[model samples]
Target: MKIAIIGAGNMGGSIARGLAKGSLIDDSDIIVSNPSAGKLEKLKKEFPGISVTNNNAEAATGADIVILAVKPWFIEPVMRELKLKSKQILISVAAGISFEELAHYVVAPEMAMFRLIPNTAISELESMTLVAARNTNDEQDKFILRLFSEMGTVMLIPEDKIAAATALASCGIAYVLKYVQA
Candidate 1:
């Protein structure tokens, strides 16, 4: 399966690197797109098998899964540009964006969508990733769970609980670290 990541920032880059180390998807099947070439170049150097492009649509085209890792402010514009198909699974790692907001941004509201809240620890392959699904079935859920499980522990939560889950798993990591230092 081809996975395209739109954003080469911390979360996106870490996910790409983590997936490259996993056995589920091959490095060659991963495509990363970013407006800036610097991060893309860095990722290409680290994982030569992966494809890097400046065009978001180019990376997303023909991809089975499109991960929107850009800043929340960019989500609407990016989604508008991609015009993602219903067959593609949309996973957004941006915090604070709900399923309703995401559905509004996309052309196809009925498409499978998920919100993933992964802590900063994802860079170390030890993130507590919280997942909230919409319009997805058992098979898709299992696939997503397995795919993310390769990076770290994954929990499937209800959309209503995403905020609470994010606080406990995502932001909680930083709080724990601060306490440790203190």
Candidate 2:
């Protein structure tokens, strides 16, 4: 299955590496795109097997899975330009964006959405990632959960509680790190 990542920054880079190097996905099956060519080049140097693009729609085209790895403010316009197939599953990692809102923005309402909140520990493969299915079927939800499971443990939660879960799971990581530093 092909996977496309919309941004290749720190978090996006980590997730791409985890999928390719962690044996969850093959290099040939992964594609990434970013508005910043520098970041795309950086990822290319590290993982030469995958493809990179400046066009978000081109990167996402025909992929079985698409990751919305860009910043929150850029999501709507970017997704508007991209066309998602009915079979395509979107995994949104944008902070402060809710699933219902995301569903309204995508080209395909029938396109499945999975909400995930993963902490920084994912870089070390020690993350507690929360997964929530949004107006999706069992097959699509499982498909989304399976992808995040590659980076860390999965906790299924309701979409309404995902923002709260993000606070506890995402922000809480920094607090834990502060405790460690003390």
Candidate 3:
């Protein structure tokens, strides 16, 4: 399946790398986009097989899965700019962004959507991630679960619990690190 990651920052880059390393999908099947040409160049250098572009829409177009790895504040704008088909699954890694918000921005309340919270450990292929889906089928959910399994352990949770899960896993990683450092 084709996968497009709309941000090429730390999290987005890591997800692409982990997915490539795990062989979940061909590197060529993955497309990464960022506003920074330097970042796109860096990703291309690191994963020559993958496609890199500065055009978000180009990256997302025709992709089976579009992973929004942008900041929480950027999510809405990115969603608005992205022209995606309803059949494509939308997965957002923006913490604190709700499924309702995503649906509202995409203007497709019936669109299959997933909210994911993954820590930096995803870069090392060991992140504890939380996933919540709306209007998604069993096959789509399983496919997502399996694809993310390569990055780390994944749990399917309810939308209402995503915030708590994010606090415990996403932000909690920093708290754990502080203790480790201490």
Candidate 4:
């Protein structure tokens, strides 16, 4: 399956690295994009087989799945710029963005949109990623969970509890790290 990662930042980069290292996805099947060439260049150098580009549209085009790992502030703009396809599944890793908000941005009411909140542990393929969606079918849900399972444990939760889950699973990791450092 072709996967496009928009935003080669921490979360996006980690996901790409984990997917590549796990061999769950071939490097050639992944495309990573960022606004600047610096980050994309770094990823290309590190994961030579994965395609890297500065054009978000280019990265997202015709991919089976498109992951939005950009900062929260940039999500809307990126969505507006992306030429999203009906068959493509959209997953957002941005914190605080709701499924409804994402749906509005995509402008495809029937589009399957998922909210995935994974902690820094994703870099090590041990993240507690929370997945939530409103209208996704069982098969689609399973597919997403399987895709994320490559990185770490995945839990399907109610959309209403996404914030709490984010706090417990995402922020909770930082808290543990701080305690360990202390």
Deviation of model 3 at 2, angstroms? 0.6
List ranges where model 3 is wrong by over 4 Å.
none
Put down candidate 2 lDDT per residue, 11-93, tens digits, no spaces.
Answer: 77777777776676789899998887998788789889989998998988999889888789988998888878768888888
- Identify the candidate with maximal lDDT: 1
Worst 10 residues of 3 by lDDT: 100-109
Q: Looking at model 1, which ten-residue stretch has the lowest summed lDDT?
A: 118-127
Off by over 4 Å in 1: none
Ranking by lDDT: 1, 3, 4, 2
How accurate locally, in lDDT, is each candidate? 0.92, 0.81, 0.88, 0.87
Whole-structure CA lDDT of model 1? 0.92
Candidate 3, 1-182: lDDT as tens digits: 99999998988988888887776799999999999898888878988999998889999998999999999999878988996788899999888888877888775678899988887678788988889999999999999999888899999999999878877886777899899999
Q: Of 2 and 4, which scores higher on TM-score? A: 4
Clashes of each: 0, 0, 0, 0
**Alpha-carbon deviation at 180 in model 2, angstroms:** 4.9
Enumerate residue pairs that collide in model 2: none
Model 4 bad stretches (over 4 Å): none
Q: In candidate 4, where is summed lDDT lowest over 10 consecutive residues?
A: 100-109
Q: What is the lDDT of residue 79 in candidate 4?
A: 95
- Which candidate would rank higher by TM-score, 1 or 4? 1
